[model samples]
Target: MKKFKCGVCANTVYFENFRCLNCGHALGFHPGRLEMAALAPGRDKRLREARRGPSSPMVYCANEAHGVCNWIVTSHPDSGFCDACVLNRTIPNLADPQNVRAWGDFERAKKRLIYSLLRFGLPLDGAPAGKGPLTFDFINDAVTGHLDGVITIAVGEADSVERERQRQAMDETYRSLLGHLRHESGHYYWMLLIEDTGRIDEFRHLFGDEREDYGAALERHHVQGPPPDWSLRHVSAYASSHPWEDWAETWAHYLHMVDAIDTSVAHRIEPRSTRFFSGTARAIRGQDAYRSNSFSTLIERWVPLTLALNDINRSMGHSDFYPFVIPEIAVAKLGFVHRLIRESTT
Candidate 1:
């Protein structure tokens, strides 16, 4: 989540930027360099001699029926699917032109998810017996996006308008396609951690008995709202529904904090040598500085910053951007995530 700029015009850019709005310079993410760079239009968009390494050859989605994405992938890095495409458990039908548009929108968001995973060095894999590293199917089944029947991802999530409508109905501001990826990755990682033998107990204590029936739990949640006063314990209302979901919700928040802090640091948003906010005034002003650095440091700075952000959002006629409070117990859970991620790379 480092800050990026157009190499051609120096315009500040985002990881998802395909072309600079300021100068119209074509852009591609050079994962080797861990930065987005401008592509000088030619045969080879792959960046050679990138400081991190040579660029991985990538191609955009051919399903770009409406030009939603310009993402590319490594030509021969173990699969034909781009990093984002690998995570799809189901994709919409290609025969229907509208499905193509939906897929394109999904691709844009999915690529953003993949970028975070790669940026943070998270592990990724596909379902068994697939040629691709990750498998997805845009299911038309009844449970596709429902809380019932083995984790349904409703096809409607691919539609921006539909997602927004749902978000409004639910009184949520921060939900997005990328949010879905982080949430789902929680399920994937829980499978990994529980199967690891050493981490199962800790997982159970913090997230609840993930062994419980997922479908039953989800059904109960839909029928009856989360435990009254759920906010005292969980980060989101939906998280209180199940242990697996609690972990996923927290995991997504962890990523949000980590990425937000990293982006802040990359841009020198904070004055150097300052730690956590020194005084009340410092604490107020220091929220802006919290964006800098790794998750470890972010946790240190986020306490005051989140408080400030909550108040600021309230003043602006919007609900809290970060709706949940990170309880002491949740902080411990997050610490486990930080340690696990650090240990993985080490």
Candidate 2:
């Protein structure tokens, strides 16, 4: 995420900030401008830019009433929600305070996911005209997965304790709400970019035949487990369950790498001079990973940076910041995703 500052007082602010700490100005993110704005109150729940005055009128997204969104939409007859909130088809019951808090976590992660999608110039509400519109459902007592265009997230996943328990039960090294969102979104985009665009032949070559019986693949995966050599060819063991899963897992990792590289660039973070880190320092020095057309450049920058981060995490006695490795074959799959996204945007 890009670093933000208060437009009124120039003090640093964060993406989720609703009020500036230094100047006490109300802050709202303008989705179109892609920046946080310092706000001054206007008539009838409207807000105007703090520094620029009342030229542009804005209103907080309706989700703001629940304290889950801090984004603003244009003040107009048809605009009441920000670009991100408009994608929600259902939310957990807000009457329960526990559900309210958990849903807040879901929205924060979902917004970050949406922010990355926007940065990639991907369509949020179903582009290419004929495809189903992308939407989200935050519900209770259901498995988290994607079907058609809707991504369903189990509300329990927002509870850190329950999420960790599920991760352990599944024998997974890493899992989070954002990870779930990115992975499910990968499924949605596969339908759009690969299936809809008639690129399945290319996808089959890299990910194997997605035509394989998915239910059988998953059942066999659970009973027999991934092949012993899974890590050599896939980003994670679960990815080996089916061709579609391989695509989604690899796609999620691609997003992870891009977002990490983008944040590193935004904060000007660089690897230090050490035997493990010296080789990659120059690769990331001035590059913007999101706009870079070279997939090789992203991997070059990502590897050493992750190594350094892993070491730092060890110093703090925390788990590795990134726990997975990208093998050569996985790199090829990720490259396919990179090209697919670039082609869609161009």
Candidate 2: residue 302 lDDT (0-100): 82
Best lDDT among the predictions, by candidate number: 2
Models 1 onward score TM values of 0.76, 0.95
**Overall local distance difference test of candidate 1:** 0.63
- Give candidate 1's error at residue 284 in angstroms: 12
Indicate the TM-score of model 1: 0.76
**Model 2 error, position 230 (Å):** 0.6
Off by over 4 Å in 1: 41-66, 75-81, 86-89, 94-98, 126-133, 139-152, 164-174, 267-296
